[model samples]
Target chain A: MDEPLLRIVDVWKSYEDLQVLKGVSFELAERDVKVIFGPSGSGKSTLLRCINMLNPPDSGEIYLRGDNITAPNVDLNAIRTRIGMVFQHFNLFAHLKAIDNVSIGLRRVKGLEKQEARRKALEALNRVRLAEWADHYPAQLSGGQQQRVGIARALAMEPDVILFDEPTSALDPELIGEVLQAMLDIAKAGTTMVVVTHEMGFARAVASEMIFLDDGVVIERGTPEHFSVSPKSKRVKRFLNQLDVLYGSHEKLLKLSEEEEGK
Target chain B: MLFQTELEFIGMGIVNSIIIFPISIYIMRWYSKKKDMPHIQLWDTSLKTAYKVSLVWLMVNILIGILFNTFAKNITIYFLIQYYVYMIIDLFIGTIVVKSIYKKELGESFMFVFIIQVILFGIGLIIGFITVLLLGYIFPEVSDVFFFVLEFGLFFTLLITASSLLIGFAIGISLAIMRVYGGKELHWLSSGYEKLFRGIPLLVLIFIFAFGFPGLFWYLESLDRLLASVIMALGLRSGAYQSQIFRGAILSVNPGQMEAARSVGMNKIQAFRHVVLPQALRLAVPGWSNEYAVVIKDSSFASAIGTFEMTFIAYIWGLRSVELFTLSMGVVAVLYFLFTFPVTRLFGERQTKKLKKLGMGGG
Candidate 1:
């Protein structure tokens, strides 16, 4: 029971000629919030995909509550139900409306009755402030609204951990705020999360532990304050320097990135 | 029965069918209007619509019949003229009415109604043929009762095509899934089936089932089994072509949809059923409609093996007057065109409209 809720042990995955993730490993504790940020092509998204075995690691193991999930004998679907994921592209089922998108897994995977599943779906949408748009299709909504519906869909599963892979990367600038705000509320509610994003403000505010992933490896891990002030790696310091310009609005993150780069 | 000869009976059938057409339409229309019979009423709507189309078509056929009767002297020429005339009306008038019946936004749930009507019409035609045959039997058998054979032969064309299309659709969808998502072995199996069925001619395949296979299998020698064999062979061959249509539709669904479904904890099969196939099937409607047109065309070859569909009956009728064979064939080609063109265009139009709502109308 004292063990972390989710653990990835030396996971590695390569697609054809591209090695997406190289020997990445981490542990996520219950009720803890994590935000991973890195440059493009840094394997941040691949690591998140590997966590749910959507792109299963070519080697090594993933354990959920001490069960080896990467084993061939394990049911990937059952394991996935315990750990939900949100993609960069808000891939909602077009044929179904927003509510049914949230309720489908509830009916098919959870075996819930129609009314119960629908009620739960509406409740999940309510959390994202999308209950009013329940009957609308994904095409009818904006990018931010669609991403919020995506979060609600994952949240409806009530998984042990939810992974967000650049969830706001595809949203319009104005829409990113709403999606991030919904995510911030989820973090405040103490749900476990692993989010990959460049939104340093969200990370600074809600992240309990932040990690810099680069070259398919975890370059640095610390509190947002600790990472901002003094990241040990020169590469991480340099990346944080660029983030300094990205997060110029945040005085603390700017001062830290500047101070560390100056050092 | 009042006709002096078989040729006169042919003439009388046109007159009687024209008269019976409106009376049948009236009764069917009144029955459809009855309250509190939802199941019957549901079917009655399509049937009434069909009756209206047939009524218009019958009038046209009568006009052509009257024109031809002034020049006709034999049963063979009468049979060929009447068949060609009816087929033309069915293609033009029937197609338009059926298309109009489906003009509203149709949910996938209503697909069963469309399919059931085809099956029911096949059954209706058979029942009507049997009724005519019984009426003739109860009376005396005149030597020139060739009109009965002609009617049965014409109706049999529709029956075989309907059955083969239904079977081919089922087989084609399965083959498509196998090709798209199945493993290496299953993929090879489906590919092999498609290649084998599509490569050779439909006539060759039909002959294999009707004549070649029956020699090896004792049960296939039976008359019913022989009929089943012919239908199955046509359907199997059609399935190969149908598979390509389905595969194209399945591929048109974006790869991201599958990933989205998986991210939500649905397995491959559930994801396909929930996310992929529903969308793919809608997109496939145009292709599937073309497959139906092809089934009618290809199944006409079933006549070579004595399956007794349109092409074979046309050939036999043409043979009766050898000098007019070329003229008969030219008319048959026109008849084929009317039956296929309009209905397929309607399918493409409706599907395009539905797909436009989904924002995928360009392709």
Candidate 2:
């Protein structure tokens, strides 16, 4: 690919004694949807959090659009303005109404006027099909609706790349579809995205490339079909096998036969 | 003779009854409307009117007593009749005026009733004076020290209670801020201050500050014993309790709010101003009111310091006349109730409403 829109090189992060990410490396072209897949504790979420400095890597270089974000001289606020993050817990400001929550960063950080920021907020909410809930507080909305507002808030910043750290992980089973559908809409709009999720079907359907992580390292990175059909690393194979047992596979009989024989 | 005396008492009582009762009620009703009714305004107005009426009646009774001693030989029965009569008349007139205003289609014009009451009461006072003068000739010597104590004592106590509460609130809120946001050293200092003050009985705290502090401080030795000792002791002790009220309020603010504000490019001070302090201060109001009640009652500690605040003044004057002591204490008790009872009630109700809105109240 011509120069990648984003490149993460040998990124390493730890929290005290626990090393969560170990020399993780990745690259993304403009408008690519990269899905990171792994069992829980695989550091997929922490890696995504590191890209935007929400959890800055202890040692790594993350360049966005040719700027070295990991460099100490880079204005992190300015960098954050161009890189948006959606949290797993949907940490929307509890006291603010949906629209105000979306507009807050715009008005305060981007210097948008109240009316203009609200208009942009409405537009972002409309993109997520949550325009009707714009004036309602988070407490008044359902979990799915609140997640959508969170997405709207992230989108209002108009970042170059969106990072999602298990966006639907905290959502109810029935509510998961609504948040995923909103994410699918974002992907269709052609924004660059990096998502850490256990949702294999979404990975299979939407991701241009998939990275399988285990114990803080990327074990396999390939096309979704390649990973699904013929994962090279034994770790990837075993991880996918366990996921198959948990979710049950939709793959053709050949893969099932292999899985059963391996079991 | 008993029938004639009772009839004359009842007859003279009518005018006094009308003047006192209606003015009190009308003032209360008018006050209630301005303050959004059934809340602060209601209590403030009623208490204010009660104080005014008590003061005016005290002066009138004392004057009448003095005049009777000079001009009429037998004024005791007349004074007793006047006291009861004026009380009844004031109640009656207050009820009529309040009810009339309540029934009127005057929109917001009800406020004018306060001005009208003052004007009417002034005219009524002149009329009452003339009537009393004419009646004095017939009834003779009908006002006494008992009447003077009732009126003056009530007004004096109300003034003391209200001033103490206001001062307490101001000191309490400020000290609370100092306790909460005043740096690590200040926080420790304020915490110690709060514990020391709130831990000690309010009476002891007041006494020590009022009596002990002055005795200990050489510079203060030359100052007026009563003024210096009482103000310093009461104000300092109040600051300690107020600080606790504030600290609790500030802590109640969510830490998330401060983080959110900082993420939005606000500095620590701006974050506190915009997001944290406003919500914390609102939450602290009921607690602050409780501390205010303590302050009002605690002001009585000034009496031990030898300040001639209401309780002290009453005690000094009461010692000479036991009747005055009973009347003075009654007036002071009523004044204290007027100052604190309604505030506590109002804050309690508002706190319930706030809790309800926050989804923290009853199931």
Candidate 3:
């Protein structure tokens, strides 16, 4: 097998006395889409942040393309450039317009010239269908449009993988679909992603693998089909059912997954 | 001319004592009333009110008489002796009157008399100061003094205020960053510096910089020592205050701002410079203007060290006589107000509107 594009080994993290992640391990091959879901405090977001060292894991190692990012003296900023992040709050730089927001990293970190960065930023905006909203400040944009700009910001970096930490969680219900659609387009383009969300329909449509985290440990890991059809753990089945009821009908979720699989 | 000066002094002294006597007693009565003292009948007996009035009257006359003899030209030793004899007589009567009126012990009545004397002097100076300004308008000779103060004094004041504000703002930004984002040692050091400077009076600091340091290190002496010391003292004090302003503005920014910047692959310093600092500065504009006003007023303290700023110039020209002193102070006060008001309005109101337009949060 070709070496996994990213690997997490025995990751453990704690905040003071409370352990947030316990011996969680995972791997992602190139162009893989992993969907992570659990109760709010299950450390799914923590794990994603650890991958980029935003919140460094207390004990364990993370490797990106076989480089040990967890080791001392590793350049974390350089590592972060290759691992994009989309926050739940859609943390767009409030001072900059959408175009500048997407272009800042490209110009600052990537050493791209002004025109080149602008062109690439526009291209990324177009990808997220936010090209016309490029000149608007984050405050002027709707919640959905802001999230799309956030995604474009991450995508412009051409990172190996993007981590979406509940991207649609802060959006109004009507606005969630547009952002999810943008994420779907990115997934279809074969960009590697790890998304932490409870949107069962989106998970059903694009997840290459599904992970269920509880009490800071992975309770279930399987193919998308394994989760919908015959998850081994009873807790996994119960969680999917709950998520399905909250997000949509199980039949509808299954139908979406089947149609995407066929495609 | 010498006889006229003495008579003028005596006349002004009588007028001041008459005006101050009633007001001081009324103020003292109001204060004692606030302290929940029992309503003593102040006017029931003719003797007590007469005593209170005369006690204040005699004190002001004696004090102003001595000032006149010392400051006015060609006042003979005979008049000085006459004022002393009256002061001794007044002191004897003042204690008896205060004790009988307030029904207080000897020490407390002495304190009461002292308090009334200070109030009389303060009020007397203010009235004299304004009278000189009025006299300047009527008399052509006095306006020359006003223009002299405006020309020579205004320049040094502007120099002190501007340079100190610049130095302070720069140091303030550095110190604020250290207090906010720096690690254990830096945070401690910056905070300690702020506490030490803010706690020490600016006058004491000026003295330290001007005399103490140069005395300890002879090589530190320079021709511009007084001016430099004034700037150093004012700048360092302003820096302590401005640091707090900037620190507050920095913290007012959403923490998510720094996190977002870092997530974009910029290091902490880059993130602070690009994302946090701009927003913090915009929020700091109002506070920065307030610091400007405070530093401008504080520039007056430079007069103590004899930098030729307006107040120092005021003192020099003022020393020719008491009337000149009053006129010089009035001019200095007006000039300081003029320097501070317009700039504060420009920054405080207009920049705030601009910040609002940009959608930057916080006042």
Candidate 4:
């Protein structure tokens, strides 16, 4: 096997007395899509956040291309420049237009020139199919449009990996499809990604590997086929069954997955 | 039978009437302009009114001068008319110049006209001095401290206002930062500083810093008397109000903003500088403008410590010539309004525009 692009080992995290991620371990090959799914408070989001040191694990080791990012000697800023995270809330700068929001971090953090950063930001926005809305403020844009801008902002960095923390979770149902379609395009373009989402259909379609977590622990890990059809753990089976009922038809769920993959 | 007053009293009353009537009209015209009356209309009407009123007053003064001369002693209506005409002309020219400059462009032009008026008025003083030199050949005991105080008083007020704002902004921003992001002890200290200074009346704070703090800092035995005390009091008191303005602006920033900045690889300081503080400061403008107006007005308290500020000089002149009190106070009031009123209005208008842009204004 090729060397993993990212490696997490023995990661432990807590918020005060409440332990959120318990001794989790994971690895990702270059350009892999890894989807983590669980019910709320299952620490799936916490795990993705820890990878970029947004919530630094209490005791853990995180390595990016064999460099120990969790070690004190490593420059977290240099590490962060290569890793981008998209938030559930679409945290675009309210004062800035979409293009400016994308360009600012590139200019300030990566030290890109104004014209060069702006050009790159426009390219990223175009890639997300939001080129027309570049001049619009976050307040002016729809939720889906804002999320696309958030993705464009992250992509402008040309990060080695993108972390998505429930990206479409905050969107209206009709708007969620647009954001998810953007994510599907990103996955097809072979950007390494770690996404924490409850979108089971999205998980089954794009993810090269699926992790099912419960109670701050990874309860099941397998390919989409295994998790969807004959999940070995009772928790996995029960979760998929509940989703099957909510979504109405297993065939519809399969079609949704196929549509995302075809995209 | 109706005029029972003594000849000297009647002459003084005529002099007082000549000074008071024109000044009152000037003030009323100024107030009307400030209320945003059309500049052309304001100028045209006030000029006509001043011309009519001054004509009637000049005639009355001449009649009084002749009558008083015939009854009690010899009097010179010539010198009094010369003085009155020069002043009315100066006031007319100053008003027109300032109003025209104000109408041309808002900020720097108005300030330029105001400064030119001061210089031209100073030249008027030079004319007075030369006239005094000519008159001293006849009357050697004439005093001129009153004119000296009037000129210096305007300059001193501008100086105090500028210093208060500069020093206030500096201390205020620093204290605001400490209050927002400092460690536990520093935050408490900043909060305590704001609370203590803002709670007490500005005059009380000035008194304490001027009279009381010196005893505490007496070991530093080289402090200048008025300068040290006034600067200390004004800076500290204005800093307290400024900090609150800053803190409120900072709080008004959305929480998601900080999180977004942090997620973009900025540390706390970088996030604040790049993402947070810029927006926060924009929000702070209206509040800071109010604080600025307060600082300008409160700087009058410097007079209590004998700082030779505008109000203090006005007081000195008022005490010497009781009639000059109303005139001097009016001058000080005009100066204060001139300093703060436009800035307040500009900030208020800008704030309204910002709200409209944000789509947060009324639907």
Candidate 5:
């Protein structure tokens, strides 16, 4: 009933023979951490990409704070600048250094001066605890470091909402924690984000609302406690069984499950 | 049995060849190493290192022939045949040595080096026949035009290669973008332009421009149509190839890169300019250098249109003394090789270093 920062309605997308996304819809409120999870071929990444018009939904109306961004002749670049995306591959420009990777869009798209962009980029990098690696190229950095750089790049945009397309998926098992920590810090800062990830701990801790998407449809969407305790759909209950192993039945997760059960 | 004279001749030539190698390859490596050469990144492996070893072998043989006059005491038919036979054996042995040392990357191109050797030997045979078998029949006036054409010819050949490559490279890059990223009409236009220019021979193009087009312009008598037509015809043909080089280079850039840039809010063109083109240009270096060699070689066809370039100079010298035609052509080919070989090798080295800096191997 409250106003939403970003809203999508009945999106459909097909690539040649593949109907990658069906009638999908969602909404993001300001300062909301909405975590979406699904198995492979669930179209989670495609849906995130569509929100920023990177994939440009074949049929859907996307409204940003009330203005319809999906209209035929909208300024896609302006709309995109307000919606940052972090990729699964961490798509940091290989040729540019970490700081430059964060600063370039500020300079180019945001029309910030060199010093201003550098300051903001450094601030963002510091936010991710990667200020020291500012001069290092993406290729020179490790997987987790690169993913942190990717997050810093997104944060530098200061977009209305950030889209995380499995940002930690490419990191080594040991490396995923640092990226998650950086992401958790960003989430605590109250930047609206729509994350598509398998990190169930992140969802339980940071996500105000959690969703289960399967075959491009939202099977379940609720507060983390509600979703965990009841998980209305049978598919979700079955899917939650597989995910608990991935979520690592650690102490924090065990505590979370207990809290949700009590709720 | 190797004679002291033949051995000394080649041995001094080897020393000379050593000096020449640095001048050609090192300078080239230094000059070309900085540019974003498309896929010209060479793997700095022992296999590719053999390119230097084998080049040394090939150059020494050419040097032996050039310095042959000092060892020209016996000019019998059997002697010339024996010298060629031994030279062939040395080249073959050199190939084996290179093979034994490394064979991964160099093996395929090593065959091309062998084919060049065969072509060189064929040229040597023709030169031998003209100078030794038909020496008495050659007119003395042939020497009169030799120094003049050789001096002026080298200068103009360099000028033509520089001008044509500069113009072609610029135009080719534009055309490549059109074919790669342009709308349907521009894509069709670029492809059509590439096909039209590439399908027609440079000789035919020069003739069309030089003989056919000069009638339209009033001030043509003052301008150097020979130079103009040679550059225009060759430059246009080169643009077609350059476009392909750039197109391939642009394609080599990962698609994710453009998507990443676009996700950051830069439009299609900005994403291409910022993210894709830099990587693509690096990938294009090898292809760019090949196109460079092709342009220089094609510049030889300028002689057919009377451009007074090196080959045309060689043609004039040949006609002056018909028997010396192959000898004159050999002189031009040696110079052509001198000009072309270093450029390709230097640019090749630079590409590898650049690729390495980008955290990729000289692949």
Candidate 6:
């Protein structure tokens, strides 16, 4: 009700002839957990990237708190420091150890002293349960551990909100749970998050709202229960059904449906 | 020739095989390990490989034997017998190495070990010749010729090589960074410099620096004009080549590294300085070592302008007599080998291993 923590108003982006995000808008309040998912080439990842202006929208307004981030002459580095990003590839600095990867943003962008930055980085790593891996390089760490380090990197920045662009998509199936669990823990700790993911279990467990984006526009937006109970659009139903067949529906959705059959 | 009679030659052949077999096998083992040859059963495929390699060796040895016999008189019989003995021992050693240590399938192991044995023999023959040259057992007429070239030539050759490589590498990396990440104008400027320098031959460039620049600039006249000109020509030319090496190295680094740095809220310059450049430099080391060797060889070109490097010194002393000229040139060739070979092996191999450990440079 009181000013949403972040606001996106009709963001439109394209690459040459291809329109990736068209008039996509969203709002997130404090401590909210939002999940965006759709079929491949649905512009879910592009919309998330547009939040931090990693890929700036062609025409749109993105506001962080009350400041218009999309406006010209805004200090992008400063704005980026406040809007953290976790990439699908877990792009940890190849040359640096886990601690350095986590602390680089703190020291460079936040202007924290080395010791202070390192101390905070370790704390963030501790949250992801990877504090012991501080000395290891990304090449030495497993996929799950590397992604956790990536999350720690963003968490150490203490940003206004974190954007996760398919954080577990690049991971092996077995490794996906640990990264999702880290995200869940962050959500429980009252962090504001906008995640683009295919993990239905994670969506059902923590997403306050689930959005289905198609053809660069939000097709459906509702509570997770609302989608499983009754999705308004046939397109949304078909897409979610395909995802369920491929990745399996969440445990709660199965139980909810079973209860409905009994009734 | 070391043994006089048939009986003595037979005894010496046995003795030589005993001594050389272990050394040959040791080298083969090292080569196999370095090649990462997988252990497998031995095969007979190496028979053909061995025969092919041995045939080449025999032809080369016979040719040399003919030359020696014709010129030195009656050395042919001894040389031919020695070559046959060495060839038999080499095949014997190759079979043993392939069977025991190489662990590759019989055919492939034989092929590999046989080829390696030929290389070993070639190296051994070269070492024997060089030792004879240095000990003055052969070419006693110009025994001091090597010392003469090395004493004076080493300084100028090193000066030109060191100066050019340093200057070239510095400008090279700057140009590489500009070409890779700079704006359109900067890219054009860097690329244009590369094309201009790379297009001109090193000798012509040296001439321009030596003659043209001195007339126009005048400051070059204060220095040793030839030495400064040689360094400038070689260095600027090397910069163009080294720039390509570094640019390729930079391009080889994963693009994700740059994206990661930028996503951390570092500006483009900050990201490049901290993230992309360090990895790119490591990747460039092996390529740059080749550049070092190139500059070393090109230092010989400075002789065209009479800067008195090893090649020029070889030329001056070589004019004394026909035989002395041949011996002097041979010594200078050895000296150049000594300059380039060890550094390439030590720097290039070790850097590759270290980079591999860091999971960089595709090593």
lDDT of 2 by residue, A10-99 (tens): 999999999989898999999899999888887887897688776689998999988998998877777777887787777666656899
Question: What are the Cα lDDT values of the candidates?
Answer: 0.76, 0.68, 0.81, 0.73, 0.77, 0.79
lDDT of 2 by residue, B1-363 (tens): 322232233223333334453555556657676768556644554444544443444344434433443565454545655645654455445544544644434333334444444555556655766765665565442222223323333332333444554565577676677766788887677677677766777667556755566565556444345545555556666677666666676776666455445444445676576556666666767777787677667667667656545566566666777776775676566656755776676676767576545432143
Candidate 1 overall lDDT versus native: 0.76
Best by lDDT: 3
How do the predictions measure up, each by TM-score? 0.71, 0.62, 0.71, 0.68, 0.72, 0.74
Worst 10-residue stretch by lDDT in candidate 2 chain A? A245-254
Against the true structure, candidate 4 has what lDDT? 0.73
The share of true interface contacts that also appear in candidate 3 amounts to 0.51
* Candidate 3 local lDDT, A1-263, one digit each (tens): 56799999999999999999999999998999999999878999899889889899999989899999999999999999999999999988888899999999989888899999999999999999999999998888999999999999999999999999999999999999999999999999999999999887888899999899998999999877888889998888888776775677678777767988999
State the lDDT at B148 in candidate 5.
39
Which CAPRI quality tier does the interface of model 6 achieve?
acceptable
TM-score of chain B of 6: 0.61
For candidate 6, what is the recovered fraction of reference interface contacts? 0.51
lDDT of 4 at B234: 79
DockQ, model 3, C-alpha based: 0.37
Best by TM-score: 6
| lDDT (10s digit) by residue, model 5, range B328-362 | 87767876786678778878777867677776423
Give me the iRMSD of candidate 5, please: 1.3
Better of 3 and 5 by TM-score: 5
For candidate 6, write residues A1-263 as lDDT tens digits. Answer: 47789999999999999999889998999999999999889899889878888888999899899899999999998888888889998888887899999998888777899899999999999999999999998888999999999999999989889999999999899999999999999999999999999888888899999999999999999998998889999999988786775677477567767988999
lDDT-better candidate, 2 vs 6:
6
The alpha-carbon lDDT assigned to residue B178 of candidate 2 equals 70
Using lDDT, rank the candidates from best to worst.
3, 6, 5, 1, 4, 2
Which candidate achieves the best DockQ against the true structure? 1
